[model samples]
Each structure stands twice: as structure tokens, then as C-alpha cells.
Target: MDPAAEGTTTISPQLAERAERSDLHTLGIEEEYLLVDAVEPRAVETVDEVIDQVPEQMRASVQHEYLRSQIEVASPPQLELSSLYDSMRVLRTTLADAAGRAGSRLVAVGVGPASGPNSRLVDNPRYHRMRERFGDLSPGQGSCGTHVHVSIPDDETGVQVLNHLRVWLPTLQAATANSPVFGGHETGYASWRSVMWERWPTVGPTPYLQSHEQYLTMIADLQASGAMLDEGMLYWYARLSASYPTVEIRMGDVMPTLDDAMLLAALARGLVATLVQEVHAGAVAPDVPHPLLMAAHWRAAKDGLEGTGIDLATREPRPAWRLLRQLVDYVRPELERHGDAELVTVLIDRLRTRGTGAARQRALLAKGTPVAGVVDWLARTTRGEM
Candidate 1:
């Protein structure tokens, strides 16, 4: 049956509820990207051109983001990691082919690697309204990243999961760090997104909360105080999504390839599952270090994996490799049980060596090629054409 064409009245609420409550592994990914042209250096305004050209099966998964130059592709809920790779590959190929037909290409990057004036690339009503309201706060119709969501059984579990997931988020951020340049200038920060996104009215790390009641109070206060326009503005480092029965982690940059994206998603699912089970069994896992979260995030934004991160337990800075070892040990049992042990090993190897996206971008720059060259590099990376 065609999913989009299916009438809303035909859907079963009970079945939907069961799907949300299921304890098995469930994962979803939303990846945002920059639309570029092989001959141009600025943001390429071409969503309509490519959308009109892609096949129907691929078009269903592809859509526009806040900006015209930005395209977001989200995978449907999946029970296994391999299925995610298949969907991602198909959508990416279709989009790339469509862009090619339009005399342009799609590049996945967290920030526009090169600078261009803020202008509408695609004409969408909500995007126009958002730009009008947010003013300069809106990165002005450019930049992109990957957001991962894993199902939670209930609100209580979601809140606790968000709180506990904080410490590991920086590591994930470091692992996927990709944005290094902005406006044609080499932003010293490995992930300048940390600076760019702060312009938004409500965004940043989730503060330490005592319990679920406290989390609710914080949200209510934000709404009342106007710090947030709505519940959507409570953009913590990681948070229980208001609309989805899942914990959403927005720490990572847009990965350049499907393999990296899937690896991160699988790891995220394993972490959430392991932690939720522990919480349900009345087992107290380790406490999150908000201070560590602050410092680690700083290092990730500054050095990617090239620099060391803070060890909250030891109160000292340690190399990313050392920190990653501790983290792998912490999550090894869960990875093994879920048949994702291979991915964990691959990620650990990457962590021990080069940094994630940011490192690759930096290397590409050192070669004396233009930022457009880097975009091309990322395209090849994601398409396995590298």
C-alpha cells in the first residue's frame, strides 16, 4: 500500500500505540544537507529542480528543510540497522541523480563550507514565516546535520534517558564533526555550528534536572517566560521529543556518508535500549556530569577528535582515544547483544585515528583546493564513489 496515499481514518490507533510501546530496537534518522552546484561557490537554490526529477519511491523520503538550499531526508522507522542503509542509499542516489540532471549536486555538511548571502533558495511558506520571525537568528536558509530518534516506552523513560544521555553526546558530536568553514573563512572551531545555532531563541545543553516533574516544570517555565516561543524551543543537547515518543539526539553534525550515519544511529539505539532496561530494573547507571558535558562539547567544537576531552570522574583531561575506550567498555555488552559489535569496533578504530567529518574537511582544505572541492569530496564519500 502507498503510505502517503493511505487515508488517515484507515489507520489503527491501537496498532500505532503498540508500535510506540514496543521494547525492541526501533530507530529513525533525519539528515539535512546543503544543495550545491559543481560550477558555483554559493548556496545552490535547487530543491524544486531536483524534487521534480527524482523517482516517486525516492521522492517520498526526500523533502525540504528550513532553507531552500537545505534538503532533509528521513528514513522510516526500522527494526534493523541494515534496512536503514538500504533506504539511505536509495534516497541519496535519487537525489544526487536529480541534482545532476539540474546541472548541480547535493553535498551533506553541517554548515555551508563556503559563505554566501542569506537568501531564499526555495520558496516555502513556513520557511518564509520562520525567516521573518527569527530574523538573523535563522542561519538564513543554509547549513545541515543529522538527527537521530529512538523510541521510548513512556514520558518518564524519555526524560530520564535524555538526562543520562548527556555525557556521551559530546563524544558523538566529536565523532561526526564536519563543519569547519563559514562564509569562505576558516572558522577556528571544528564545529562552528555550536556558535551558529546559539542565535536561535531556545537551544543549548539540557540543564540538570532532579526528576520528571522538574523537567515538566522547566518546560512550563520556558513557555511562560517567553524564552521559548513554544515547547519546540526547549532544544536541550538531547531531549525527549514533545511530539514523538522517542529521545532525540541532535548533537552530531550531518555525516558525509550513509555508513557513518548508520553507525551512529545503531550506537544510539543500543545506548538507549541498554540504559532504559537498566532504569526499569531499578539499577542505577552512572550519573551524568553536566560540567563534563560542557567541557567535552567545547573540545569537540574546538578540536574534533584531534584534542582531548575532560574526564568527569577523574577531573582531568584525557585523549579522545582513552575516553572512547572507557565508553566502549561501558556499552560493549549492549552492542554485543544487538549484533552491532562490528560497528562499535569500526567506530572505536575511527576514534583512535582521524577525527570525524571535521578532520576530513580540514585535510581537504590543506590540499589548497577551494571549499567547493570539499563539497565534491563529501559527495563522493557518501556515495561510496570515493
Candidate 2:
């Protein structure tokens, strides 16, 4: 069955829960990009043309997103961290050149502009059904995001990992807030994409689930209730992959630079490894309440890295960056074990100096650079040209 095909009424078969844990954690990362007019900075319907220009060898890795103005690329799963970075850099450069040749620029933005005409749906059956069912929600569906897929041993392990991963969803959101400006004005929220994405009934930090049986039952219920048309529409922040033996952490907006993206990819892998280890040792995952997690998600979207985040431990506000640091410390040993320690350290420092993508865009606007300038800077940084 095609994962993207809509109208499946029942959940698909998956590996049994509680399979033996495999030590090796491979990584596969996907990033969705927006195609913008080269000069005016509005989203343009040129993804089909740009995709046509991709070299034959890389075609398998690239595909259309829900909107005509968006494209997505995924790296093949790999155990080596350094090689994965090189692979993504190549994809971005290749796609950027292809977009430029098609008279557009590839931007690593979260949400497309609200001022211009809405992006057209991708010319496909699945997308049309989505537009028909979701109504106004489809208009802003051009939002781009970075999805990290890390190998898991089995569905039961993946479900357990999802519970462990839920606590960090807000931290990931705060670090990757990139959609500050839409409609050529400040939206007052750092990751406006997160706000928009929540309109879907299934999208959120994954709920605390008891077993793999519950995971299957939940999807079946959602599908029967019309809240979801297929398993592909289960948009939890983290979930068991339907197509592969992996746990997918897909809560982040696309980062502005490759370094930012790699930092997130590294963190996702490290966190998963740490959690998996804990699971093997019979440790209980945190008993964080759903209400607190929801509040934390909202606060992170409001503040990004520049303001306060809810410390899950204390349920009180702390500097968002401090929370980010606490996360880094928590996963440092796992990162070291995965040989990602040195690279993550350098990337985090760069983030400290450069700030979140939303912050950089705001800084450009504060200097009297128009929205077009912000868009151009985003395009340049996306291709590592600056």
C-alpha cells in the first residue's frame, strides 16, 4: 500500500511491540523547502519545473510536497554522522541551483507569505482530497518542516520511545522557530508554523500511550471518525514509522542553515539513543502531564529561544536557551557515544552567535531591510552562500 494514498479505513500492519533493541541507530533526514519568486519573495508555483531539472541520480531522493511551491528531499539512512551532513548539503545545493535555473529561489522557511495568493495544491489526487476535507487549513499548508527518522528496533520499542521523546518536543520547537514573519509583518509568534499546523486534529506532541495495541487502536478510531483519512495523516510530533523500522521525530520547522538542520538531526539521534538505552535498563519514562506539555508547546512557539520555556521538571518558566542547554547536557553522553559530540558543540555555539532563523529575519527587518531583504537573506543562508 502507498503510504501517501488517502482513504484507507484501517491501520496497516506493523512490527510487533517490544522486539529486541538493536544497538545501531541509523539516521535519515528530510527537509521540506519553499520555492519563492527570485525578487518579490512571494511563494511561486514552480516546484514541478524545478524538480524536472534535478539530475537523474538524485531524483529518487526528491519529491513534491502538499503545495506546488514546496519540495521535499530525504537522505538515505546512514550510521555515519559526518557523511549524512555532506549528503544534505549536496541535496540543498543541487535543489537550490535547480530552483535558480527555474527562475526562483529555494527558501528554508516555515510558513509561506499570507499577503500573496495562496499556494496552489500539488496537482495530485491525495492533495485535492486534503484541500476538500480541510477547507481553509489547506491555504497555509505550505509550511515547511524538517523531519528526522532514526532507526528503531521495533514498533513496541518505537511506541515506548515516543513517550520518552514527548518531553522534549517543546524544546525542539523553541530551538527551530523560523516563521516569524508572514504577510510581510511580524506575526508576534516565533514559530507561526506550529500555530498553523495545530489546526489539524492529529498534530501535536504524541500522547502518553501504554502499548503498541493502543497505538494501532488510536489510528483505527481516528480513521473511522473521519479525523484522519489514512495512516499517513497521523501527524504526531513523534511516531512509529509506517514505511520503515524507525521512530520519526518530525516536530521542527525547517532550519535556515545546514548547520542548524544538522544540529537538530544530531539531537534527535542522540535523544533517541539515550532513551532507548534507558528503556533497555527498565527505567520508567517521565510521567509528564498532557496539559503541561501543551502549555510548554505554546510557550515555546511564543518565545522561541529569546524568551522563557516551561521547565517540564518544575512546570515553571526558565530561559528558553537554558532549557536548550539542559537538553544538550542530558544527551551529551549519548551524543559522544554516537560520535556526534564535537560537531554538536560547534553547531550549538554557532546557534548562540547567530540566533534562531526567526530572530535573524527580525534583525534584518529592524535594520530597515524590507521583507524582500529578509527573504533574500533566508535564501542565501539556505544555500550556505553567506
What are the Cα lDDT values of the candidates?
0.71, 0.85
Worst 10 residues of 1 by lDDT: 1-10
Give the clashing pairs for model 2: 17-156
Per-residue lDDT, model 1, residue 305, is 69
Candidate 2 overall lDDT versus native: 0.85
Query: What's the TM-score of each model vs. the native?
Result: 0.88, 0.94
Predicted candidate 2 versus true structure: per-residue lDDT over 126-207, tens digit per residue:
7788768877685653788988888777788888889998888799889999999887789998999899889988888898
Per-residue CA lDDT of model 1 for 138-239, tens digit only, reads 564476767787878888877777666776777777767788888787898888877687677666677766677888898898778766655655667688
